[model samples]
Target: MKTHALGRGAPQVTEFCLGTMTFGTQTDTADAHRQISMALEAGINFIDTAEAYPVNPISAETAGDTEAIIGEWNAANPGRRGEYVLATKVAGEGLGAIRDGAPISRATILEAVEASLRRLQTDHIDLYQLHWPNRGSYHFRQNWSFDPSGQSRADTMAHMEEVLVTIDELVTAGKIGHFGLSNESAWGTAQWLRMAEDKGLPRVVSIQNEYSLLARLFDTDLAELCVNEEVGLMAFSPLAAGLLTGKYQGGAVPDGSRMAINGNLGGRVSPRVWDAVDAYAGIAQAHGLDLTQMSLAWCKTRPFMGSILFGASSVTQLEHILNGLDLTLSDEVVAEIDAAHKAHPMPY
Candidate 1:
């Protein structure tokens, strides 16, 4: 488990972050703890979760259950909180169970942070992220027809300012250490940086967007923005929701998989997506590497990647992923990936 500075002078965190979205759903508490223990033993000192976890079928009943599991682990393992860089997100708008589906305003941010802190059983969050922008996002297959022409820039900036002030308050109160953005656009990140600069609020240190060999949407503008601004990219779903793993190859949706619960893989399992996955799988096979490792290694090669967040329903799967932390792709392999990308670009 290689460690990198999250930002200049920021705490060093593992390059591979253990994702706990399945803690209360596909994974039981015992298995979740075992996985955490295994990851820590393997030298992975970063864990990422969310307020609305167990997300294959995110429901009101299971909301916050994942965080509660982590909280329990933290309580059970006293004095271990400082051992890892814990990151979690506060769901933005339209979570009917939380705050009656309200957008994250200053008041709502205060409430959300308090609720998250209680659920996480921790006083300070290493990285707290906005799950998504209040308006909307191009993530989750919404990029095809994403239109931002009609959005109110002034209103968006005002709302961001309000959230930043609340974040400043939270920082002062020792509720959160650093702030981050997720499912956000370059414009949104720019607004955050500008407001934080002018108002002397907290500047974002990371952006947790989906980035994988199959999902290269962040390779262009987000990559450049992160490189120039020093905001690290905490890439989620570097395997494209397991698509790049070749587990669902040939349309085989294995039983008890995320695809089994949500067959489309969150609108990711398209016909063209399989073609792309197979191509990459072939590349990995030719290199005598697991497709999962090849994909994760490709993500680490990116200029702005801070850490890659990967979740596993079982310890066996996690062990395989952990083995790839030191797996670096050669230029020949990268060229093969580029060729594959050009052949099957934007399959999802």
Candidate 2:
């Protein structure tokens, strides 16, 4: 796996970040452990998870179970904690399991960090992220209905300042190495950057947004901002919820797969999305590339990509993804992908 700077002055991480949202829920503890070992053995040293994980049926019952699984791996690994750069997120408001769906405030940040530390079995998080903006975000197929017109500028600024200051405290106290955002917009990220600079608070190190062959919303303005501001883009759902894997090309959902677990891939499988997947799959076949690898490698081609987070329900699935880590997409393949994208833009 290739290494890249996480963000400005942040730790270096593998270009591929292992995603663990399936832990504890879709996957059991032993399986999760094996997956971790496989990823680390393959030189992927960056892992990302969320406090409200064990997803595919996120519930109050499995609320921090994913982190707990990692903690168990740490407990068994003994002193190998520093081998990988661990990253996790604090669930945003409306996740009643976490702080009763309260808005993110100074108190919430402090509380969430302590809880995450315990479940992760580590003293500090390498990259602490806000799972979603408190003001709401356009991710998770929410773009069509997202509206910020009702938001108050003063209130938003106040909230950002307070959160930044609290994150600054976490940085100073060694609870977290750096702060990041997930499912955020370009404007929201720019505001955070401006606030951090103006208030001398810690700047955001990364933004975990949904970006794949089917989801290119980040290509225009956010990509430019992330590149110029030194904030890395941590892309999640790189396969468009298994659509790019080609296993679901004919509406076939393998048992225990993400699609089989969460119907419609969290509503990502729109009317036009399947056609887009087939086009990309055709390109992969034409170029002798695995669809999954082609999709992941294409993500790395973006100038602003910090890392691509991929999840696996089984060891075989993980191994399949790791096979693409060393691939470098050629200019011809990239051009074909671009052409296919133009023909079928914004499937989701």
Top candidate (lDDT): 2
**Where is model 2 more than 4 Å wrong at Cα?**
94-97
Candidate 2 positional error at 276, Å: 0.6
Q: Candidate 1's C-alpha lDDT?
A: 0.87
lDDT of 2 at 282: 96
lDDT of 2 at 102: 80
Q: How far is 198's C-alpha from truth in model 1 (Å)? A: 1.2
Tens-place lDDT digits, model 2, residues 1-348: 679798888899999999999898778899999999999999989999888998878888888999999999999999888999999988867466766788888887888889989999999899999887888777778888978898888988999999999999888999999999998889999999999999899999999999999999999999999999999999998988788889987768888788787788887888998888889999999999999999999998999999999998888888888877899999999999999999999987
The ten-residue window of minimal lDDT in model 2 covers 92-101
lDDT for 27 in candidate 2 is 82
